[model samples]
Target: MMVCIRRLFLLLGMIATPAIASPTISVLTDSLEHPWGLAFLPEGDVLVTERPGRLQRIELATGRQTIIPGTPTVSASGQGGLLDIALHPNFADNRWVYLTWAGHCETGTATHLGRGRLVGNALEDFETLFVATPCVDSGRHFGSRIVFDTNGYLFMTTGDRGERDRAQDLTDHNGAVLRLNDNGSIPSDNPFVDDPRGADAIYSYGHRNPQGVAIYPDTGALWIHEHGPRGGDEINLPVPGGNFGWPKVTYGREYWGPQIGEESIPGMVDPIYQWTPSIAPSGMAFYRGDLFVGALVQTHLAHLELNGETVTQETQLLSELNRRIRAIAQGPDNLLYLLTDQRNGELLRLSP
Candidate 1:
């Protein structure tokens, strides 16, 4: 029965809708102090983080806010700030919450991962679990997003720190998807563990600045959306030992001028989807709900449909939202929720 329902959705997604509905945007909370990340608790409370290093809990019904203490200090520079927050897979029992942020080192800023227990409105026994080593001096590229796999491993995305060449460097953890045990230890089965040139912590390599990652509930596949140089934004299925050709091979052009890398390189992986003109895509989620039949069918992709030129009935929700869409999640009631990025960003709910 489940397989039949999934197949039906796939068929409907290829068709077009007659009308596009405008989302009803509401200001859930303002003056949030540069909100960066959001996650929902099982009891219906929302946890949000401020880029300047503060965590707050928002009551879903009352709209009341409480600051969560014990958060670590963040660099909070250009593009470098308190980044992503994720609840542990078993948050109900463990109360564990994970955080990814830009931490300052003697040389510069690097993305770091930390975990703590959320007790009431405070964080208890907070500890730094993993820190990106050989930190660079620039704050340009801190690709710090967190997602947990069904196998009980925590995966994180890291940028190349604006050093284009590092994307192909197996010796560094930058521009790669890192797989680690929940407690911050390297997994023994990681793909590059024994490779002399590769870092054991790496799961995949050759990425630019990946900002969004989510696991497809139905397929358990890891999906990622990354920023391209001038125009080529990409959606890819991240697999261990796969090389998602970035600076070495891209469908995008250099920011300064004409095309840069070749799109056809030996052994380079191709993106499942690419967007020209750059949506600057971030924080993706696979919607598995009854409200949007079309979206549910396209479970593995970021957007509901392909490019505008290909589908006239499609609505460009990302462009209409204006601000960079930071995070996406499905609520308890099976409604789609989105987090916008900006000083006065909003939390939007999408339903039928």
Candidate 2:
């Protein structure tokens, strides 16, 4: 009888496999041209950013797209384009919005964080809030992901601009997590405020190219996942004033042949999770919902979860969705939404 029950279970597994909609995909908006970032407003409208520096609004119910005017021009070169979009904490009352993009600098080009008032249907009072110091001409490695902490401080990640040594430079803002007040002022409580070696805005350093950043709703801890050189993607929990050893102490190599650095570093913080042979992780989010009971607790995200780390007995989704996922966020309906990266990208919705 036990053998017969086991055989019945096996048959049920096979029958239920193909029809299960894991990482369930649904099109929120179709015919969108290179949508990079998405932020839902209080009234259920979503503001999406196009890579070529255009902002648009999509009504959730109607699926209508309207282009927002008065957006700033961006450099739009190799990996340098309109990036993350975030709404101000008090957006409903304040009508403010923030954006990050690669902008033109006097020397060359650099990533800039700008804020403005989102009037009834247009963006007004555009202001360049923060410009990365010592702008370089290289258009690559513009890590412009943005997130707001519990204290209403803005955190932005900047890449090393294809220069590995810049990750270790204290004076340089590249390859560092920068903390700023809402209006782009350095907080007096920031770590390294008086350190002559490092900039005051530098909260933590030694990152390759962090794209995904989200605050843990339960613990208020800041979590990030960055792309590795050739392999060795990392999920890190950043502490205040901590030094995350990048090229100096990486699980990855130089993409040519040499090792990155020694494994034993005294003061450097090691990643809690590391993936070898690379998942090309771009965006991350912590799942907190009741849709998948007995699963989905502090689940770190990636496009694929072949060798993922999780605290619950969750199943791997998106096994066949062969695409580089760029962003993930929770929607108003308690469902998960994701954006795929490609020439013809897609906005996907997921459920249990």
Candidate 3:
């Protein structure tokens, strides 16, 4: 394993006082090689995916980690490698685990989804489910995040490989949100299932390196957020068969600060929230626990504060952490867990 040095330390971004109390942050563990995603098992252990290509379980009680044997030989260069991890909706009974990663494609690498059964400390019956089409040599943009909606369908994001033109081409699988069955079959009701104009598995299109995907369990509303070029980081509510207008109608500009395209077009959907100067948003989760009260108590979308498809109030929660947050997951206990993107990624616990 290649080791990179990064230290995880405490940060109090907001000062605490008698009238206003800020959430406390604690370092749970460290020494993770750019940990990319996180999942909690039925037994209460937390699963982590290191971008360097390792899957490990961390004991919540002790922070002790056990490397789970049997991960695919992932392409671990650039922004590729092991990405997102999710358990079957019925994980307790079936023990099925799903993973999204970068794999060897026709010439270079492509985003792939696979599933295996976790038995003891190893994965068994591993199989590839889906591979994003058009293998590109670039290692920059593989937007691989997996989520299961209430109806038990899988949705995964695919980036455009930094190729701007392909995002506008429906025939290409790049830059789209795809809907598939648990077994990797295209969902019959997917927007493009019968349309010869686009990939049958695609649900929506024109995305730019989306890194976060989550479904509101109660509402079953799907939400996604992605990175913009320089400015224009955005959170979006994706609709079936809808066009998001990446290179054509983005609020972002080119790397050197030249405008990319118009800010709005007729058919392209607009983002609910846009961040200029790019905070580099990665992973996000809607709060689903009893730990939060007052401003969050039974409120609708308090953290990101989303009302339907729009964000009302947003707060900066981790400015003091001084690290790029790669993923966020709300544990069963309502405590929010954060994975920092670093050579030595740290597991952080945020509590009110």
Candidate 4:
């Protein structure tokens, strides 16, 4: 790859920990348009999803971009469109690439999951696997991020689609984390598999616009973070059948003024970490390499030090870039990579 290194020596800001490493930032390409999700291909190239309803591949060696055809017809409205991308665990053998997007359904538009085989520059045999129910006409709050756990099971997240009351309803697929097999079948062992009132794919429920989900290394636990209305952005460790209180009980309030609900309730789960004044966090990743850092993004990169399940310290890095970091991934080389969310987005890489 032709990498041009630019050393950034901005003032280091710390919340509770020592100064973080000021890694040199390299802009791989600045031509991406609002890139949402990214997955590194086995051959060293990268697959990126643009929210404007297009899929493209980046040739890291030369910074060449090629559009991958056969993507689903997406509702490129307010906050809905082509979202997250993931690969099957045995991608080298199966060539299965999974995608999450907002698609038109019988009721309206909803988050959907589908997969296809990657053959050259196009996806062959594309199939729409799973579609969220009770779709609404609103174009907001599509919580769609994909991650595969260590058990080879696929997990996907969905938002309430702007209907906050739907989060508390188990009968619908909205506002929940879903578990399924790689082929998009609901797992028999899913928490709601036998419950007639709940969707068979739901693993956990009660979320608000969760745009980030990642498997915690070594522990295999699913870590998620969702955006609240006015404030109360939360980072949570979701368990099977777990109910994270949203409108029923939240640290956030309505955009107009009033508090939504009690901060803590009896049976509902509270967040492990929360942010008031809303950082508008999007993507999350845990780095176990040299720096042992956990990366979460707002306007800047938040480096969190994890002591088991507790966040011991935090440091904000790369605020000088002045770009909204939409997603972050730890590359195979153990370095950090980021996607800026803008019309003229850029794919950036950080090296220690």
Candidate 5:
């Protein structure tokens, strides 16, 4: 009975109570050159990608780094470089580490997907699985993020490369998601498989520049968040071959102040959630730990509470630290890890 009184007093701030413990934050490693993506190995080692076209393996306990060799030379332009990385779901059996990056092709700079085994600090047996077709010289909008589903298929986001109109082009690879087997083969059952007029690898279309992608915890839905023009950042569940209405239907105006496409085109899918001023969301992971729930909200503006498909609550945890969030992940120890995008980047760890 007295405990209830104490709780009420604490909530009301009517009594001076003991301070509660909060989640701890620490910088695991700095000196990363524009670190863009992060992944964890089964053995607790960390894999990180720097936009300057380097991949490094980090020792978590000591925060030491060893540069993995044999990466491709990337077209390090405005918004392009080595982007995202992911481990093969069965990493225990397959030592393959897949990577997405921007490279100069015969036509121009394009987003590329490739993989190789992590053999002795070198990427051995590397092969390019796919190259975005009709490459343009512009280094922006490499809508690139990678996620693997439960059925062992890869889903990757593709940007419109500053060519907004191409998003509606069924024959173009820009502004779409690609589904493939680990070996980079398109699945036969993909939405456009039967349509020779579509880009063979396309799973969906009409995306702007999605940098964050994740599978929902409660539902296995493949969700994505993309950058909007001026005021309409969006979170969407892209359907196979579905049009998301970029350039044709948007809630945002052009940079110079003019309405974009129609607000509600009959055939386009609407976003589930949107940010007006834009959070500039990057990498993401679903929470799997028991800490920081009863006391504080999840860390640093990355965690979300949901009721089925709807986000019931949203939060930003470490904005006080003043870092541009680039990636978020639940590590093997059930803690949160993050990367910041900057010239001298950092890898951070959060513990409850």
Candidate 6:
């Protein structure tokens, strides 16, 4: 009982102290062009993907950017291009670098997952692993975030490609979170495995442009956030076979001010947190190394205090930057790194 009371008081304290101290922000480099995703190499180097079909390796000590060769030819249309990047859990031994990109498909474009070995400055033996199916020609809503959980299982997200009804379908990969083995094979224990009604790789469905996903500290729960039309940006903790309602149930409206759907549904999973005016959330990471459950918000860094899986308090930081913070990750040195979205994007480091 004492432990429960103490936790309650702690959460109250966090909510009461909303003005958390801001971190010291410094510009590491301003030379990046629309940097989308980043992964920290074991040797302290950073691999960043630019949306325009380019992969860059940045030497942190000297801020030198080198264009890594052997990237696939990307569609590079609207929201299509090189997207997310992640290293294999055993990358030190396997030297494997996995990436997600908008690739040309018969219909138009689809998000493709591929990997290659990093030998010297180029990706060698690059091969496409898995491709999202039923590609559509639309330029909007390609979610595409890659993450590996503690068990070494790979999780990737895909949007509905601007087709809202596709999110409710289980036969296609649209608007779904997929799980696979490190070798790109479907896991037999997947929620929809052997179920003819759904795709085998889909773990969760009915998301709208989810761009950020991270595993919760200690619990190993995978958390995700997605973009809503004019409002209703959401953060969700997805379970296997979960259905997160998008257009059929949302807190958002059309861009011209019309309701999309009902605010809630009987079977749909709702968000743990949501942004009504739409902060336009992009990338996210838990303060994992520091043992904090917080993550960066859209324009500001948000410190989330959680009691178990529930977010009890949220403190926003770094609002003064006034920049569209795209991706954020905690570095090896325990500092936070942020990528600003722009034609002339920047890499910023934050020291707490």
Q: Which digits, one per residue and each the tens of the lDDT, describe model 3 over residues 201-289?
A: 88888898888888865578788888888877777788998999998988898888789998999989988777676766677777632
Question: Alpha carbon lDDT of residue 181, candidate 3?
Answer: 97
Kindly provide the TM-score of model 1 when superposed on the true structure, using C-alpha atoms.
0.86
Q: List the residue pairs that clash in candidate 5.
A: 143-159, 300-317, 300-318, 301-316, 301-317
Backbone-clash count (model 1): 0
> In model 2, where do residues sit more than 4 Å from their true spots?
1-23, 289-316
**Tens digits of per-residue lDDT for model 2 on 281-321?**
66666654211110011222332221233433333344344
**What TM-score quantifies how close candidate 2 is to the native fold?**
0.86
- The TM-score that candidate 4 achieves is 0.92
Per-residue CA lDDT of model 5 for 1-352, tens digit only, reads: 0012122222222344356434456687878998988889888899999999999999999899999998888888798999999999987788899999999998888889999998767899889998888888688899799999888899999899998998889888888888888889989998889998798799989888888888876667788888788767778897888889897877778889888877777878998877665566677666641111100111244446666677777655565666777887778887667787888788877653
Q: What's the C-alpha lDDT at position 139 in model 4? A: 94
Q: Write candidate 6's Cα lDDT for 185-246 as tens digits.
A: 99999999978999999999989889998887778889888888888988888889998988
Q: What ranges in model 1 sit over 4 Å off?
A: 1-23, 289-302, 306-314, 318-321
Query: What pairs collide in candidate 4?
Result: none
The candidate maximizing TM-score is: 4
RMSD of 2: 6.9
**Rank by lDDT, descending?**
4, 6, 5, 3, 1, 2
**Per-model CA lDDT versus the true structure:** 0.74, 0.74, 0.78, 0.83, 0.79, 0.83
Better of 1 and 5 by lDDT: 5
Which of candidates 3 and 5 is the stronger one according to lDDT?
A: 5
